[model samples]
Target: MADFDEPLCGCLQDMFSCLIVFCVPCGGICIQAYSVDKATSSGMVCPFLWSCCLGCIGSAVNRGQIRQKYHIEGSFIMDCLISCFCGCCAATQEYREVMNRERPK
Candidate 1:
């Protein structure tokens, strides 16, 4: 009975751990998805509006560093989503710049 209880406890712990790892990322992605939809509907791809995404990504980076130093299961995954979205936006800006630079009069 004791051995069975230990395994059960371990499994429960693992489930909680996984949830903590994913929850922040899920939230961040939802926000970014909304941002995209809003941008498309408005017909304005405002790079300045993406500053919020940068903030979220910065938070994630900070959390990741905290986790590294303290070994805490902080919400660092949010950082990943933010970073990905920000990177995509930045790349798009660079592409636009290059295209404009090559445009003929």
Candidate 2:
């Protein structure tokens, strides 16, 4: 997974460098960039020391637990029923069509 700072840095460079260096830093829902802060912004220097800093923070919040709400039977024949809603055919197209037709009008 690429980080988010690379594209931003590339953009800044392109905007300042007469739009010469084109950097497409994003691929499949992620982007990365490198940024620096100093007494003098070296736009150039690798001239100075290039420092790469990366970090990730993730958190998970649980919504209270609920019991599995399915009728499970111990027979293979019944397994098929559970898989397909106990033999009740899902009228996917009909349902969608009715929902669409009933909208507003």
Candidate 3:
């Protein structure tokens, strides 16, 4: 499986996403969830609530979904760890991955 286009440590590379995550992590996550499935309100709200109540699990699940969609190489355990410790960074990384991959080159 291919790796994510942007590494987790590269979160700071995108100043806009980095600042969004740093200032309002849940909003960052909400943006990601919305991007993934724009048609569904649950897709947006569920992850936002999850991040609010269970930071690691919510973001981990969201990360897993992104990984699955892009066929990126990673595991839920690692996602949980990253989300648990580096929630903002992870969110920013996820945002960058989606934006980079989906945008036309």
lDDT of each: 0.36, 0.19, 0.75
Question: Once superposed on the true structure, which residue ranges of model 1 sit more than 4 Å away at CA?
Answer: 1-53, 78-105
Residues 1-105, candidate 1: write the lDDT tens digits: 011112212323434333432465543333333333332333223323443445555434432432343343435564456355553332232223223333488
Choose 1 or 2, whichever is better by TM-score.
1
Give the higher-lDDT candidate: 1 or 2: 1
In model 2, the clashing pairs are: 3-31, 3-32, 5-32, 5-33, 5-34, 6-32, 6-33
Q: Residue-wise lDDT of candidate 2 within 52-95, one digit each (tens)?
A: 11111000000000001112113333333322341111112112
Task: Please tell me which model should have the higher lDDT, number 2 or number 3.
Answer: 3
Clashing pairs in 3: none
Q: Candidate 2 has what TM-score?
A: 0.15
Candidate 3: give its CA RMSD in angstroms. 2.6
> What is the lDDT for 23 in model 3?
79
Give the alpha carbon lDDT tens digit for every residue of 1-105 in model 3. Answer: 998778778976888877766676366676666645532224576767766677689778888888888898999999899888887778778878777777778
User: Highest TM-score, which number?
Assistant: 3
RMSD of 1: 19.5
Candidate 2 stretches with Cα past 4 Å from truth are 1-90
